[model samples]
Target: MSEQSVLFVEDDEALRFATVQALELAGLSVRAFAGAEAALAALPTDFDGVIVSDIRMPRIDGLQLLARVRALDKDLPVILVTGHGDVPMAVAALRDGAFDFLTKPFATDHLVAAIARALERRALVIENRRLRAALAAGETDSPLIGESAAMVRLRGAIERLATADLDVLVEGETGTGKELAALLLHRLGPRRARPFVAVDCTTLSEDGGAADLFGHAADSVAHTRLSRVGAVVASSGGTLLLDAVDDLSPAIQAALLRVIEEREVQPIGAERAEAVNLRVVATSRGDLAAAAAAGRFRGDLYHRLAITRLHLPPLREREHDRMLLFAAFVDQAREALARPDHAIGEAERHHVLAHGWPGNVRELRNYAFACVLAADDAPGEDRQDLPSRVAEFETRVIVDALRASAGNVVKAVELLGIPRKTLYYKLGRYGIDPDAFRRQGT
Candidate 1:
């Protein structure tokens, strides 16, 4: 069964119901909307689902909705249903980024196949977005990517600690990729194949948050129809990432501490505590120790989580990694916008190195986006767009990641979000030293 969802929009109720039923019968989830307007209003910016819409709607036609969706996220897949006469318009829609167009009276099976293709594309686009975001935060699925000694030491410590199975606390400045480090730890450790769940501490409420974490029994709440199992128990035999743990309320802190201490969870309205085996990885942007010392956070809980700690290095502190990261982000932005790569001049290079990067990698990402968007808009007569200079820079970014990983092609590919075969091809194209980058005596 497909895990992805589809937003199906049609003005005709009968067609909508029939199509939605067919999709559901085909083991796909469908949310039917009466018109394009409702679908547009219901869609989220980070919608992970595909959309199927009739192009000839009464108001806010599919083409207009496609335009709006593109404005929000260019990668969103918008599949249009076109009439026999509207084939030309559908072709035009393709040029404007519609995933695919379906003609009227198409087979239900054909529609399902199209939906599958759209879902596949949607998955790739969203995954690429996530990968870039992680990279910009100075972290990767494999591990931290940096040539700096600070990063080297951090990776070494994490590697040693990953095998210990102890709960971890990751502290760093905001946007410094604390969660990514935790994810890397989980991915590299013994629980790699098990579930890795992440809960944002700040998003939970005192009343429901406790129940949400520890779960509630059936009829425990006034409205909920079924019993709930919380994060702690759900993550058994795996890992639970507590993001922004410092924001956890005192009440939640106490409840969480009890769970940590007991190694079990007593669900709301349940008579017994269920024993659980799992690892906890907590992330905090501020000083957790100070919070504990100030009595704002539970000191015992802090001690439990802080047993193993890793501090992420800020972008400015790592000289070589910053430019390497910037180039990658530039590449990301260029690819996202479907623009040619940027050609960074000496002046642009100096500017990148000189800036304070107060917001760290996030600020650098925005600057990179601005640089890419400024392609033809750059002023002065002799001003060349950044894409022109990106030919060698892209190769350099690839080489830097490869070099940092010491010729571990798999690790470099993971860091650069490129395929192993593709990187090898590029390596040959660029005449890079896959061996020279190998760590000495390794």
Candidate 2:
């Protein structure tokens, strides 16, 4: 295991010595600073450690240091040590973005627990930063390939929204590149340097109604009895992409609304809420208005999330973009498989253009990969027939998944192991009736 570092700041000599001794004994590398100024001067933005400081230090106190730290790294965890009477001050420190506070004269166990929590918070910050960096380097342009009017307009919207700090709600059919659009927005925005945390709300449900957006406290309890930090608390100073927000239960929706409204997240086991600066972006294939009307989603939350909505047009509507996207996917497939350039034959292009891509861009990419694999396998046969085989394989997978689920849309969705909306979109693409099984009373 890697060693955890801690920066301990306390004006009291005896208390500082005892605290450093305790931390060191707990297997932490301690950097003790007698005053806040000394600690603040040495702590840079790249310092990945927990900051334990007294709330009532002499010059440039804990709050000021916290403010300075926030300016440099918003996710750094700062634990404030306060006297018994300084509860109000501790609360103020929390509002000013302190991770957590411990009252003075507390037991060593209490202090150690606080430090452990701070370290956990620091680790999350580092992870989030790394993820954001990867996203920035990987996705700068619209992932959807097309030159049709709808595609042009969609890309324009993404470009325009990328410049602002506002929340975005992406509405599109399955495989319409909702995640891709979200990634483009994050890369294009000011918070590109920060993290982009994506959550699949559909997979997180407790008892069919209560869903854990952040992990449960009960799940985090251990033999040592320390509570682990949850995902919502982990993603600070960045974007949190909640996929399938439509699937979230009403209880989870209410909790989410509180986080967005307060700009803070209360971890499952923590007594206090940690202040966070997050840009929220939600995606859904269902009509949010209908969900709200049915009381499945909160009305206020819907309004809050839909501040700016971007709709992605389906593949059929973007006919002009299809050829461009197909060519782009072909090039990408070749590069991905380390194969030489292979042209799309005239017959293959005709078939591709004539057949409606119900799976949208993602479906096309899969087909392209299959074509490349097929071409590689054929030593002397005509490579031009590879596209048709790829298409056939794609169709087979779709049909098999549908058949396994007995035509039950929801069950088929589970069998396909894709998003509910994506499964529905594929059914539509293949001209399968979603309610066919229900109509037959099967």
Candidate 3:
């Protein structure tokens, strides 16, 4: 089935057939089940669709099914339908994390609209997860790419710690790629094939935040009817990244300390604690030690999470890597936008060198794309024509290749993926002295 399809459960044969027909006519792809058991059994862990079930069913009812689905994947949208629903039941369902509730005799349009909205939200959630993973994992071999000494040391530490399986705390400023470092640790570690779940502590609210991270048992949380799995449990056998860990509420921090200490989580209202095996990677912008000492953060939690630590240097501190990263980002942007190569003019080079890049690589990458897209709009003769820009890009590429190859024309040609004669022709056209690089390196 396509990820865009839906799973629908209803016990009534006539209503099930009629609703399925209506949903199909409304251009939705749906799989109809006679009971909740069948639907629950067919559920996929990475299901990207919506679930609509009649709340008043035998054996496994809609609310029970919703609870099970939440335990499986909290983000999966479950819409409960019942002709017997009262105001309180509906309110309770919503509070219990039901996506939406519909009463029978409800208009076909109303159900369809509800399903559409649920599907839309599901798509956004899935896409956000995908994009976040991609951003953290990156499109390159190494998530952290630079030749700076700080980067080299950080990479070595990460490689060593990744295999040790110790919980790690990454300290860095915003946009310093803390998430990326956490992801690298996950990827390079034994849990590479497992889930990499990242939670933003800043967005965790006091009202239901603990339930969100630690999960809740059915009826454990007030006005809630479902048992939901939390992120900590969801990341079992993998890596749980606590981004901005210092931002966690004191209550959550205290709860998290137990999970880290015991390697088990007791769900709200649950009788037994469940054992979980996962690596925890926490990131903090501020000094967690200071926060803990000041009582702003839990001292015990910080000490537990900091079993191993990696600190990423800000962009300004990596002076040697600025131009290298800028060039790479520009190339990526040009390729993504399917545009002609962007000539790095004096203005761009100067800005790359001079700017503080408070947002680090993220800010630099955005600027690179902006420059590529706005190349034509550069003011006062700073912008060159397509041919001139292409020529300039060509020169830079050849120079870089030569530098990498130690000015060995044969090696440079191979590195550039070009014919030797073609590389020679370009080198002659651009007036680049290959021997200059050779003398400096080889």
Candidate 4:
């Protein structure tokens, strides 16, 4: 049997023949059996399709077959056909992980629709398993791994700006790899041999921050008696990274602006200012220009830092890079934890592509690590009950239908065996924009 072929088992010969014909007519490849034992015998451990069986079969019933299938592979999807009297038993089986249960007089369209969804999910499962296996032999050298147009442009800009001895402002949303961009600039520049200093502006104390950034003479203030070089002086010949510069207080901002303007630092309690060669790379999570205009930041400092600005693309904007990043993080996590290779689930892959990663790369990396740590865990890293799982599966099915139909609501309605109004309602509820799939297809 083909990998995508379905195994249909029913004790009633006429019903089994009729259902098999309906499935085949729906363009599915199915193998019909008169008993669960025969179907189980023919089932493959890596079956990439659904199993449909009657619940009231002699000896090996649908529930017993489902248990056996679960033993073989818990990921395998099993659909049971239950009579009116057996509805309660079918519900219990669903709690035990039955994929879907159809009533005895169920329409063939419903069965076909259920099978289509099952096959789509199974395909994702198989694909993820293949990717996991490939990860063991795969590797990436660059810290930035992406081939999207935005990423390509960013790379070219980085390469060009790396050699330019100019102060840079790296701006983006949180977790967009602003620091990584700064480091790349430093690494690819003439200042590669110098120490790269990174200071968290948010952590700097209001009173002691100046002393920390601009060096202090011995007995400077009451903090310490020993002489100390601050981050600026220590990074005189190197590149200094000011992280979350927007979070700095007004006093610290004024002090920093002076240091940038003079290209010199005067230690606290010192008599003379010392000249220094420096490259400053400041990162912000907000629009520095807007902040400056609003009087939240010094305009002079903003202009000086904005001479060479690099904005890292957020994860949502880097459409093609999502999977590349996810695969890399998965491999990295597996190696770090010394865990065996593991597959990502259908829902995880869906989330990777569909969800707007507000936290960008950082959020995706954390999710990948969590997935590696717990293979059976839900993609959201939370324990999901049956209803949540069902909802997730339903969403995946709708998305897949949209993709297959190239985002045409009419076409998707036909493919999903649902009303156009129902599809639209679900789309709204799930916040799925069909135009995205349309663009992808084109």
Candidate 5:
């Protein structure tokens, strides 16, 4: 996801306001202007964001702004909005390097999808430019590779909250890189040199768990005669990451709450409580508050750990990032296997992009490894990378849309944001039985 702001220039106040609101709601930072002159005045020559403008605006129009933008930065993306009569003009702007053109009265989906793709392209351009500069300076950086809007916002959120010194609660589905976000938080914060201790609650035992967390001296418990170093004490002056905190036993939760409240840990068998100066970062794939309300988790603990929360969007909801991530994973896999010739084809790209990726990044990583091996060693027709994967994904989407709309064809079309004719063609092309979904919906 691109965090770069979008510059929206439209003379129509109502359209500008509505579009701006939609874009912002879609997680874009927007700068809306009444006309080209105002937008141009505000646009810095080194602006990193994409420009979206109406072509028929008064005085200096969008094309004029596009020309000026080209003079400043030829690579800067300029998307133009055009009326029915301005199609010719909008088409001509493509020759002059306009990123894309959207017709007036286009559906919200049309505009949004276009803007998202454009921003993803803009992010690549900016990243490439940065890489060029870095290479010239003999520097290198590892970027979290994703171009989807969800990823863009995730990166932005991490950067913004990294320095805030707030205890963070990260929530996401399994394999959504919750721990990765926590690592970034620690890496980018004041505690870079400190220990980042991660404990999987699922691995904690009821017998030894509490002792492992709060530390234990010999003779404190029936488990052992030897003293133990717990995560809380071990993580002092650093961060204690609780992976899957929802699995933390209620007794442990209460103890954790005390640590947050008192800024200290009470080690078992110790006469006095020990002072602790540490940050807590906890991750959960479950609905923690609901679990607390359901008597499965502690409410006070929930509130304490949720000082600053970050939710990582699942891969299915990350849109075009699927392809981006798959490519990165493929590159990693190829490099690991010492086969630089192993590359993803267009069919594989389509399949990756269309896949639901139920297991998120982990699943994608495995698929990337599999694809690399198969494409490298397997004979022609025996390879697994094919259009069948794309077809299956398409079928799933279509079936879900049909189920969502019940037996209503028009509603299904609207749900999928596709034209009625196109929907029918896909239904026939996939040989989908929409009646099955209609019955399921009923």
Candidate 6:
């Protein structure tokens, strides 16, 4: 394994040289500086090393250096060396965020142990930062693919919304990429470095609501004995994506409304209110307006959320981009399967375009995966067998579309190419109840 780096700052030449030699013998890279000024000048913001320094030094002292390091990197550990009489000053350093204080004439083993712990802490911090960067990259690269006019407009809207800080309401059918859009907004927005919290309103219940969204204090009656950190607190300086806001209970809705209106959040058991700086993006598959009219949703909440509503049209309406989306999905499936590049035959492309994908891009992706798997299993099958496989594929597609479209004959006919009479016949043949597919609203 590679050696960890250590920066040792001590005014005493004998102690500094001896310490450097000891650390070097232990397979660590040591940089010795006789004063704090030299060490501070050489330190870079991205330096990954444990800092060991004597508490008493001329010109710039160890405490001053510790403060400077804290300003640059709070996670960087600083271990202070002190004499028996200087223990009081060492304790003061601890209150100022020093990692730990060591008495002089300390055992070599004790010094090595402290250095190991500090290096381990530095490693963990670096790993966390790396993971966060990877996550942000994924968000930027994996955007929704479509070329229809509606999709183009939606993309433009996202680009515009991402530049500002405002509440967003994304209205779309299930699997229409609302969450993906929210992520894009976050990655492109000013709060990109902050948290991106997602909350499912449908899953929020009174039993553990506070514990789930707002963390409990160490001492409180409703603490539940187990400390919990809520998503709202986790996403302090970023964006919060509230999925299915229509399902928010009245009480929880009121709490969320206050949070949004006041721009602050009070913990479940805390007396003080903590300020929150985040953009709110709410998504829903149902019609909020109708829900509000039916008393199923709060009118005030709906108005607050609908400040800038962007609707995602169903895939069936985006006929111009159907083939483009199909090709994209094929490429994604190929990469995922680790297969050689594959192309959709002209016939296969035509078959895909003929049907209306009611399940939207999600259904197309599933079909692509299934088709690839089937082809892999029967590598030698001729085009003569293609129709049977295609028919099976069509059946599955129709079933999913019907389920998503809720069996409305006209919508089903629009989604599937079959006539209204033929759709009803297939629904009966497939043991599907048309009434069960009907949504609450026409």
Give RMSD to native, each candidate. Answer: 26.4, 35.5, 30.8, 13.6, 16.8, 33.5
Residues 190-218, model 4: lDDT tens digits: 99999899999888999888887988888
lDDT of 4 at 73: 91
Q: After superposition, how far is residue 275 of candidate 4 from its true place, in Å?
A: 2.2
RMSD of 3: 30.8
TM-score of each: 0.54, 0.52, 0.55, 0.61, 0.55, 0.53
lDDT of 1 by residue, 220-261 (tens): 887886899899988999999999999999889988998888
Residue-by-residue lDDT tens digits, candidate 2, 156-270: 9988998888889999888889998998888888889988888888787655223245544544344535455455655677788989889887778887898888988776655
Which of the two candidates, 3 or 5, achieves a greater lDDT against the reference? Answer: 3
Query: What's model 2's lDDT at 90?
Result: 52
- TM-score, model 5 to reference: 0.55
Error at 398, model 4, angstroms: 33
Ranking by lDDT: 3, 4, 1, 5, 6, 2
Q: Which stretches of candidate 3 lie above 4 Å from their native place?
A: 1-141, 379-442
Between candidates 2 and 4, the one scoring higher on lDDT is 4
Model 6 ranges off by over 4 Å: 1-142, 219-224, 380-442
lDDT string, candidate 3, 28-75, tens digits: 999999998999889887788999998889999988998999998888
In model 2, what lDDT does residue 261 have?
88
What ranges in model 2 sit over 4 Å off? 1-141, 207-212, 215-224, 377-442
Over 1-442, each residue of candidate 6 has an lDDT whose tens digit, in order, gives 1356888999999988888888887778988999998898889776778899998899888899999999989878898886532434745776687876776666677688889878876774564454334434553244666655787788889989998788999988887888888888899889999989999877888767656777676655352565566788788789999988887888888888888888888877787888887799999998898998999988888898888888888777877666656666666777899876454544455667787777887887787777666666655422324334334334544555566567666776766556678767766666666676575335
Candidate 5: which stretches are off by over 4 Å? 1-143, 379-442
lDDT of 1: 0.80
Report clash pairs, candidate 3.
Answer: none
Considering summed lDDT, which 10 consecutive residues are worst modelled in model 1? 380-389
lDDT of 4 at 347: 73
Model 1 TM-score is: 0.54
> Model 5 over residues 145-250: C-alpha lDDT tens digits?
5656677777889888888888999999999899988999989989889999999999888777998789988888885798888899898878889999999887
Superior candidate under lDDT, 1 versus 4: 4
Error of 4 at 365 (Å): 1.6
